[model samples]
Target: AEVPVNWCPELGTVLANEEVIDGKSERGGFPVYRRPMKQWMLKITAYADRLLEDLDMLDWPDNVKEMQRNWIGKSEGAEVDFQVADMPDAAIRVYTTRPDTLFGCTYVVLAPEHPLVASLTTPDQEAAVTAYVEAAASKSDLERTETKSKTGVPTGALAVNPVSGERVPIWVADYVLGGYGTGAIMAVPGHDVRDHEFALKYHLPIVQVIAAAGDDSWDIQQEAFTETADTVVVNSESDLVSLNGMSAPDAKEKITA
Candidate 1:
């Protein structure tokens, strides 16, 4: 059986050394690459704890360790269910570090490539949706990275705020991805980076739910403000008050409560 492989046109033969020439093609000076090949694979389920221990003992910088810890993302938060407007039985759920953002969620977004997008998109927007999806697919992986411009198509579907009972528009955007924590996200533009960009691009409402310490000089027009210190939940419809002297995590709980 001939197995699929990554073949560099410039390279004459199949690669034998997994690591060579700064991890480039050994032949013809082509850029060698690693592509998924259907082959016998070893399951590392038995090495989970051992691998974790090895990582803990590594002589790495604090920032690197912190990044690993963040990637592991072992934390506690509420799983809030948001009801989809117009579609009674359908809903999009998201997990957030700050449930305090629930009231600030001006819009909800699914990855442009999300499966639900097709079902949720209105008939009038079908053509536009198809075009946006095509454009998103044509973008290179680097171009689809988070730093790229926030592009989206209005699904014409709305998600009801579980707390406020307000209907927020659902948008299918390339900035959100199926591989992320959730394929869908409730966009609290006031607090999130990507959401802020999307709101600015679409001229959506951006309410500042949380405030910074000292002087409130953070400018949303010039840049995204994500400094999470001395945050106070402003314009909250609920009884949530200014989260003074509370860390972001604790503040989220108090506000949600």
Candidate 2:
């Protein structure tokens, strides 16, 4: 059956995402990337809610039912749109769970295969961006997930934050998967571990937006403070929006509303 298999161009074979390791073909150690050719999907995803409801009538263990529920993978988050700087008509959309940290976003990251990559890249960076994209095409989503080294190339383009109106640099990072939510993300270094690591490696600015009760003295350059429940917003005020001094939960409610 035709399926959306991980196609390894170098290996000349299609593989399941599980079959690839560290972005290479498991059999030949060649690079692999996702290619959506005509493929068969279970068609069961559409009935996930029905299956979840009917599981209650079955004689299955609670853990098994919970496992089934988890497998369905329903995620909740808000999709925020970022306008490309200098490209009045172009925008990059990203899904973020922490919309409250919008003020801290210092950079935007797109999957190497992101459709806007070509149009967004500046002429001076075209060669580098092209090379990075080609290299990243060889990496599987799992490889990108497993490798925490924070590899990326600057697209030489910028995106304007919708909330803060600040312009942030754009980078093409393999850690972002083309098939994932919007293939784009706002890099909030001070509140996200991965983003923090990436920012540190690249020397990008890390703005602290969430501060705990006693965290006013904490140095975010040393570490990212991600404790959501006990934190309050800080350094998040601007002409357009302001969540400064509000609790994290309250800020999220207001920003999302």
Candidate 3:
């Protein structure tokens, strides 16, 4: 299968997860980076559900069972499509656990290696984009996934927010990995920590579309993002839908319907 691995040029070997630390091989302290390679592997994902279920019935230590559960890493979400501006046939697909927050989307991010990036980037940004992608090629997956002062370059293209029909800019960012999900993400900075930090660094707009129940005055400007039980949808609307005044669950169903 084609997948990313921690590859070290100095040792000419692929290191295991533990063998790579801070983007270097432990033995030689040689720099390693994620590279796609055809490797013999097992597709254990097919048994993930069964494996998780069996843990509950096993007479194992509580901590061990929990560890196994974490390893399975199941995430439930919907795939949303954001079409490239003026190019309906070309699109960016993203998987998100928060489909109900569609209205809050302020921008879209594509992994540096996503297939569509090259075609979508404008001529004016070609040089900058190429340089950024090259620099990102040598970073480990862990370093890229952590959004510490998230870094990205403009593609000089935009995508249309599916729900609001708003035109949002597209960027090729290091924090998003091509091997994960759809290699693209509809960034809802108002409710997501990674997205929020990226937005703050890039000076992107952050608009709140959900609020604490009965507190219409809640302000996202104060960094009030809590996945609390008491919450309601707010400021989410379009010609085809209005999630305003609805709960997150209800809004998800209505919008996805």
Candidate 4:
């Protein structure tokens, strides 16, 4: 929740990351910490899918329409409920656009504002989680969404990966907004950039479950396999569902079933 910023005391202004050339403000060469504040926003995300679907009807140029499509950022995925480990009554519901990679889930993330945050956090993490949630309170919805830096605190509790049967740690982060999707996400570090960043920072696991249709060049240590055009599942199999070697779409549908 505590975002980094280039705060320049000489200029008395918080400069943007790009504006700070070599740790100093570009204009005055003032020393700054890349941090600051800003505005309000409305929840227009509920209509993102509708907006993207109707984009073709617009008379705008292809480039502008493409931009609009990117802005909408609508993802088609499934909602999965990961039951809490050792806690029968608690579960965290997550919406993922890549359910086929369920076997690769290294951890789970919950929004700081999630209702189960306080209850799910173990006694050991109470102080740190409280500080994090309190710090996150200052962030606006827009800020939280746009924040690229990942910050989180472990709940000390784990979630049973529904498909893989792996006990993955649960974390609370501001980036996962309480109102977004299901306020939680199955963190598949091997397939998601943001999740990968967090995993690397925290020394968590990164398991690859997808690869190019015919290529086996993916290296989990380097980066996540985000391309799905002709990708197939790899290193993803369980007694309940064996998605290995299937195309992304087929694998998704099969797993979701």
Each candidate structure's count of clashing pairs: 1, 2, 0, 9
Please write out the lDDT profile of model 2 over residues 153-193, one tens digit for every residue.
Answer: 99999999888888999999989887666889999999899
Clash pairs, candidate 1, are 25-32
Stretches of candidate 1 off by over 4 Å are 1-54, 59-76, 213-225, 239-248, 254-257
In model 3, which regions exceed 4 Å deviation? 21-24, 29-33
Query: Which candidate would rank higher by lDDT, 1 or 3?
Result: 3
Model 3: per-residue Cα lDDT at residue 50: 91
lDDT of candidates 1 onward, in order:
0.68, 0.85, 0.86, 0.82
How big is the positional error of residue 148 in model 4, measured in Å on the Cα after superposition? 3.4
State the lDDT of candidate 1 residue by residue for 1-257, as single tens digits.
12323344455444644422443554555754333245554445355456556777989997987787665555556667788877877888877777876777889888765667888899999999988876664332334553467678898888888866788898887666554556678888877777787899898877676667555666655555577766655556643255544556766777568
Model 2 weakest 10-residue run by lDDT = 1-10
Name the better of 1 and 2 by TM-score.
2
The candidate, 2 or 3, that scores higher on TM-score is 3
RMSD of 1: 7.1
Across 1-257, the per-residue lDDT of candidate 3 in tens digits comes to 77767789999988876787776888978988777788897778788899899888999999999998998898777999999998868999999988989999999999987889899999999999999987787677777776367899999999999889999999999888887778899998888877887888788889998788876665675563656477888889889789998889888888888
Flag clash pairs in model 4: 5-33, 5-34, 5-35, 6-33, 6-34, 6-35, 7-32, 7-33, 8-32
Give the winner by TM-score.
3
Q: Against the true structure, what is each candidate's TM-score?
A: 0.69, 0.86, 0.91, 0.77
Superposition error at 71 for model 1 (Å): 4.8
lDDT of 4 by residue, 1-257 (tens): 33334456788765544575544567976655423244244667788878888999999999999999987887788889999998899999999887888999989999887889999899999999999987665555555667778889999999999988989999999888775578788999998898899999999999989888788977887897788788888988778879999998888899888
